[model samples]
Structures are given as C-alpha cells and as structure tokens.
Target: MTAGETVRGLLELTRPINVIAASVLTFIGAFVAGGVTTEPFAVAAAVAATGVAVGAGNAINDYFDREIDRINQPERAIPRGAVSPRGALGFSLVLFAGAVVLALTLPVAAIAIAAINLIALVAYTEFFKGLPGLGNALVAYLVGSTFLFGAAAVGNMGPAVMLFVLAAIATLTREIIKDVEDITGDREEGLNTLPIAIGERRALQLAAGLLVVAVIASPVPYVLEYFGSVYLVVVVPADAIMLYAAIESFEDPTAGQSHLKYGMFLASLAFIVGRLAVTVPNAL
Candidate 1:
C-alpha cells in the first residue's frame, strides 16, 4: 500500500467516528459535572484519554477479529489487506500507551476508572465476545464509564451517574440489536452472541424491553434538576425515535441498529443542550 493508503487504513482501524463520539461523551460528562470551566485541564486529559482508549480498543478488536472480518466484513482494513494484523496490534498498543499516559494525569478516581476500562477493552474480544449477554454488558459498561471517568476527573460524579446509566442501557440495547444483525456471521464463526444464544426475535424483544426501561428513566435528569426544560424538549423526541428503532429492529436489524445510533446521538445532544441551558440561563 502507498503511504497515504497505509495512513488511511490505520485511521480506519481506529474507527475515528467512534473515537470522536466517545470523546464527546466524556466531555459531556465533565460538562454536566459543572467542571468544564473550573477543571479545564482535567477535562481535557480525561477526554483525550477516552478518545485514545476507544481508538486502541477498536484497533485491537479489529486485530483479533481479522479472521472473522474476512467472512463477516471483507471490506474491513485487515480483511482487505489494507493493514496487517501485526501492524494493527502494534498500533493499538501505542494508542493504549498514549491513553495510559493521559489518564495518569487525571485524579485518582478517574485513573481508577481508566485502568478498569483499559483492561476491559483489551480483554473484551478474546475473553468476552463469545459469551451471550456478558459481552454486550461489558461493552455497555465501557461506553457508560466515560461519563463516570469525566465526572471523577472533576471530583463530582453524582450528576453524571444518571447519564452513565442511560447511556449504558441504550448501548446495551444497540449491542443486542447489532448482534442480531450479525447473527449469520457469528454463527458461522462459532461465536455465541446474544442472538445466537437466544433466537433473534427473542433477543430483539429483550433489547426493546431494556430500552423501555431507559425511556421511562430518561426524564430523571430533568426531574432531579440536573438539566433544564430544554432537555425534555429534545429527550422526548429522542426517546420516541429510540422506541421506534427498537420496534424496527424486529424487521430489519441493520436499519434498526442504525436508527438507534442516531436516536442515541440525539439523546446525547439533549444532555448537552440541557446542561448548556442550565449553565447559561438565556442561551436556550
């Protein structure tokens, strides 16, 4: 591959969009904890650590999933020969090192969270992926932990706790839907995902049920006075969309999962807007 191609492949291996999204989530955590202004440096370190850790996790996942990708995702970097497995592994290690260095600069609580997340990320593919709901839960916790990590960086984790719970439930729902979407490949590879362990319809039903709980609890931030009225305005529609996606997954798992992601992103925006409205009274 040309140098440019190699660089692009490396970037692709990191799943830059996911890294950015995760970083944003971490920042939102800090923002919600009312520390974005007072603890700017700590927030930056936490966000950077989250992004690097997510990139490292993705790259490592790709490296371990190279063989599966050849069948399930032939267009992926390693499957398509855009990047070698060894290169991906090495790159992931470097990213992990960077994440560790950044995390070490944060508070003790944040450091503890980061250590757990880093270990979980590394162990996920090999040790957890083949399990049923265990793998999905692990992934959900990792995603949700960003909020806790960010809040911890600023020494205030109470406000971010709700966000973490909401995000984790939503992520768990999506992961199960994604497993349904990938059931064929998972079965072929002899990996027992949620959909493989339970029937696809049952798995999707469980996903929808879990999302129902999340939607019911979604308004708690506003009720707890953590956010403002604008949060309700945005979160209501986001919740509606997520509910629709869960229903849609029964028919088209791919489309359902994609829509769920969009809805979740919208929900996250609600948190941001709500937090902003509270912090800046006249902004909304």
Candidate 2:
C-alpha cells in the first residue's frame, strides 16, 4: 500500500471520530470540576491522555474483533488486511502506556484513575464486552469516567458526579442501540451482547426506555438552579434530539443507531456550552 493508504489505515485503527468525543469529555470533566475554570496545563495533559487511551481502546477492540469485523465491517483496517492484528495490538499497547505515563505526571489521583481506566479498558475488550448488561454498563461508565477523570485531576469531584451520571445513561442508550445494529454479526460470531442474550425488538424497547430516562434527567442541572437560562435553552433542544432518536431507534434499531450518535454528540455539546454560559461571564 502507498504511504497515504498506510496513514489512512492507522487513522481507521484509532477510530479518530470516537477519539474526538472522548477527548472532549476529558476537557469537559476538568472544566466542570474546576467550576468554569480549571488549570489549563493539567487539563490539556488529561485531554491528550484521554485521546491516547481512547485510540488504544479502539485499536485493541479492532484487534480482538478482527474475525467479527470480517462480517460486521469488512472495510476496517484489520478485516481489510491493511493492518495485521498483532500490529494493531502493539500499537494499542504503546498508546495505552503513553496515556498512563502522561497521567502519572499529574497527581496521585490522576495516576490512580489512569490505572483503573487501563484495567477496565483491557478487561472490557477482552472479556466483559461479550456479556449482556454488564458489558454495556461498563462501557457507559467508561464514557462518563472521562469527565470524572478530568475533575479528579484538579482534586475536585464536585458536581461532576451528576454530569457523569447523565453521560453514562446517555452512553448506555447509544450502546444498546449499537448492539441492536450489530446483532446479526454478533449472533453469528457467538457474541453474547444484550440483543443476542435477549431479542432485538426487546433490546430496542429497553434502549428507548433508557434514553427517555436520560432525557428527563437532562433538565435537572438547570432546574436545581445550578445553571442559568442558557443551559435550559440548549439542553431542551438536546433532550428533544435524544427523544427523537430514541423513538426512531425503537422503530428501526439499525438506522436508529446512526442517528443516536448525533443526538449524544449534541447533548455533550450542550453540557459544555451550558457550563461555558455560566462560567465565562463569571470569569470575566
């Protein structure tokens, strides 16, 4: 393959799009914990660490799912034969180690969080992901933890827990939808994902229900007077997006899976903006 093809293969192995979302979570965590303003250097380092960790996780997931991908995603780096499983695994190891090392330089809390994340990522990819709700819940935790990790870096847990809970539920909603999307390949590959353990239609119903919970919870921060009108404005629309996605997923999980991602992204963005709306004026 040409150099361009090689570069594209590496990018695909990292799942760069997912990495962007994870990195943003790390930033949001720090920002929220510090209450509108956090230590920039430490937050930046944490963001970098998050990006590396997410990339590693994606690469390792692809390494483990190579055979499954041959059916679910033939164009992926490993399944397409552009990158070897061992190569992906080694790259993932390097990325994981780098993220840990960076986090270690921050504080004891950051180091501890990094270690836990590393352990969870490895365990989830290797074993937990094939289980039913357990795997799905673990993934949701990981998503929310990115923000918590940021907050913890500054030695402030604060209201990050609430945000973490919101993120976790939203992520769970999307993950289940994704499982519905991949039910065919997962069943053929003998994976025990929720949809496989239950039934696709049942899984869809559960995902939709869970998403409704998240939507209802979306306005809590505003209603509690923790945020201003800006938060309510943005989050309402974000919640609407999620509700619409949930309804669609119930109707057609495969297609619903695609739209749910956009809804989740918008929700995260709303959180970030809401925080900014409150904090930016205070900072000035």
Candidate 3:
C-alpha cells in the first residue's frame, strides 16, 4: 500500500470518532473534577490520560475482534490486511503505558484507578466480548467510569457518581441498539450477545426502556438544586433528542442505531452543560 493509504488504515484502526468522543467525555470529567479539587493541571492530565487509555482500549479491541470485523466491518485495518495483529497489539500497549504513566502523575487513587482499568480493558477485549450481557455491561461501565476516573484524579468523587450512572445507562441504551445491528455477525461468531440471547425486537424494547430511564434521570441534578436553570434548559432538549432516537430505534433498529450514535453525542453535551457552572457541596 502507498504511504497515504497506510496512514489512513492506521487511522481507521484507531477509530478516531469513538476515541475523540471518549476524549470529550474525559475532558468533561476533568471539568467536573476541577470543581472539586481546583487542580487545573491535574484535570488536564486526567483528560490526556483518559483519552490515551480509551484509545488504547479501542485499538486492542479491534485487534482481538479482527475476525469479527471481517464479517461486520471488512474495511477495518486488520480485517482488510492493512495492519498486522502483532503491530496493533504493540501500538495499544504503548498507548496503555502512556495512559498509566500520565495517571501516575496524579494522586495514588488515580494511579490505582488507571491500573484497574488497564486490566479491565484487556479482559474486555480478550474475553468479555463474547459473553452474553457481560461484555455489554463492561463497555457501559468503562464509558461511565471515564467520568469517575477524572473525579478520582482530583481526590474527589462527589456528585460525579450521579453523572457516571447517568452516562452508564445512556451508554447501555446505545450499546443494546448497536447489538441489534450487529446481531447477524455476533450470532455467527457465537458471541451470545443480548440480541442473540433475546430476540432483536425484545432487545430493542429493552433499549428503548433504558432510554426512558436516562431521560428521566437527566433532570435530577436540577431537581436537587445541584445545578440551575442553564442545566435544565440544555438537558431537557437533550433528553428530548434521546427520546426521539429511542422511539425511532424501536420502530426501526438499524436506523435507530445510527440515530443513537449522534444522539449519544448530544447527551454528552448536556452533561457538560449541566455542570459547566456548578459547585458540588461535599456531595455524598
């Protein structure tokens, strides 16, 4: 392949869109952490740490899932024969090491969190992906924990837990929807995913129900007076978007899956907006 083609293949392996979205979540987590500890530098480092860690996870996942990708996403770097599995694993290890080193610059709690997450990422990519609901739950936890990881870096975890739960459920909702889209490949690969364990229509119903939970929980911070009218203004609309996506996904799983992808970004924005100007008072 030409150099340009090779570069594009590497970029595809990194899954830029997913990694960048995870980075934004990390940055927002840093913003939330900054409110608690008032450490600007730590927050910045945490964002970098999170981005690197999640990017590593994504690369490694693709490395392990190359065979699956051949069926589901043939254009992926490994499936398309653009990058070798060994090379991808090495690249992921470098990214993982960088993430751990960056986290070590923070407090002990942050370091421990990073270490645990490193192990979990390896496990998820290697083993959990084929386990029925177990793998899906792991992905959701990783997504939600990005926020908590930042909060921990600053030596505080106050109201960020609420955000973590909110994020997890929203992530779970999308993941289930995506599972519906991937059912064919997942079943063929013996992955036993939720959509395979339960019927696609049933999974779609469950995903839509979870979306309702996310929408309902979105306004809790305002209800508890943790945030003001600004949060309500943005979050309400975000919930509406998710609600719309949920309904659509129920009606048409494939199209709904696509909608949920963008809708997830909007939900993330609402999270940033909700906490953009807030002070958590030694939250429980």
Best by TM-score: 1
Assess each prediction's global lDDT (C-alpha) against the native.
0.95, 0.83, 0.78
TM-score of each: 0.99, 0.94, 0.92
The lowest-lDDT stretch of 10 consecutive residues in candidate 3 is 275-284
Query: Which residue pairs in candidate 1 have backbone atoms (N, alpha carbon, C) closer than 3 angstroms, thus clashing?
Result: none
In model 1, the Cα lDDT at residue 62 comes to 96
Question: Cα deviation of 22 in candidate 3 (Å)?
Answer: 1.6
Q: Candidate 2, which ten residues in sequence have the lowest lDDT sum? A: 32-41
The worst-scoring run of ten residues by lDDT in candidate 1 lies at 180-189
Model 2 backbone overlap count:
0
Q: On a 0 to 1 TM-score scale, where does candidate 1 land against the true structure?
A: 0.99
Q: How far is candidate 3 from the true structure (C-alpha RMSD, Å)?
A: 3.3
RMSD of candidates 1 onward, in order = 0.7, 1.8, 3.3
Candidate 3: pairs in clash: none
* Angstrom error at residue 144, model 2: 0.7
Task: Please provide, for model 1 over 62-99, each residue's C-alpha lDDT reduced to its tens digit, 9 standing for 90 to 100.
Answer: 99988888888899999888899999999999999999
- lDDT (Cα) of model 2: 0.83
